[model samples]
Target: MEARTGREKQVYKKGSIRQVAGCVPVNKTTKKILLITRRKKKGGWMLPKGGWENDESEQEAAIRETYEEAGARGKVTSLIGVWDHNVINKKTGLPKATFSFFEMEVEKLEEKWPEMDERDRQWFAYEDALKVLIKPFMREVVEKCSLAPSNKRSKKEFSESNINKNLKDTWNLKFSAIVVFFAFLIWYLIKDNKFISILT
Candidate 1:
């Protein structure tokens, strides 16, 4: 795999299936969610996840990805679900992709970030984090995290918060865009006919 600025290109063996793992770390006492901030890729706020290595169990792979990406340590508690999605590789036109999901509550939250590559790691309240997660499924998984055996928050609480945050973010983004558009229009009107010609 070649690492570029905010992108990674990985080469896999032909006809080989790839396995990936992720962790959904929820704080038991605070009912907050933990997420790692690595560089964004493909326009998504991705989780700390990666492919399985030689002879590594799926669970071990998941744990390793979590540590490497998030600087947190935990054990796989349960299977949230598996995602088998396909993407056409533009370079090869072959249906190249990965199948991945997460193992929930695999381990307890660590007090200190693990010594690894420098990545910003932080925990957000369930509502706040969902807004930043690029994947809808991630929001869904974190909302469900409170239902895990180790979670302290009630399921209903997380569900409501998740929904509310989704709505809030939607409206906020729309409103911001509208405001920017209007500001640009006013600027154009005040500037001259050249601005109008450019828009047209």
Candidate 2:
């Protein structure tokens, strides 16, 4: 697939904040996040993100960015949130771009990609992935994923385990109360023989 290049037909040339779409690609089983090398200066790892054309939605743009940059794609999930930051674009002056980052549970990583000649991709452990990133907003995306339980399968399992523990505790407490009530009844019968005799 050919990568979309240049400032071709992007949204918000007139608007104040330019809207960019991004993806946080993760492998749930390996618990790793995918990061790609910067094609130009700065020469550090970052998430896959870029501007979409006028026609497609932000989600579609995000998925496209992921595949184009990282050569990875999968189930494109929830939007983590929108992040706003300034960019020193020569053409646009000092306008900020708000990136709508989404989480993608990556299923496929290609051997060759459209921009493979310019960029390289690798997978990193969740926390380590956050450390390698230079952009604050990109890090924010990973951090948001870390805190969001629904995004991770392990988090969902933890939640289920917690619920089971709570139920077990409740059952134990009820059992103890029943045992205590029976003990009190037996003790009262022994202490007051006249009460037991009247019952008989």
Candidate No. with top lDDT: 2
Candidate 1: where is the Cα deviation over 4 Å?
Answer: 1-17, 40-45, 89-95, 103-117, 147-200
Residue-wise C-alpha lDDT for candidate 2, range 1-200, written one tens digit per residue: 78998776788645656789988998888888999999842479999999977889889999999998889979886888987665656776756677889999999998888788788888999778878998877887898884344456787898999999999999999999999999998888879895679788
Error at 127, model 1, angstroms: 1.6
Span of 10 residues, lowest total lDDT, candidate 1: 1-10
lDDT of candidates 1 onward, in order: 0.62, 0.84
Task: Give TM-scores for every candidate, taking all chains together and pairing residue i with residue i.
Answer: 0.54, 0.70
Q: How close to the true structure is residue 171 of candidate 1, measured as C-alpha lDDT?
A: 100
* Residue pairs in candidate 2 whose N, alpha carbon or C atoms collide under 3 angstroms: none
- Clash number by candidate, in order: 5, 0
Candidate 1 per-residue lDDT over residues 6-107, each given as its tens digit: 213332435533455677765656766677665542343546777766556667767766766666665566767665435666666655545455644524
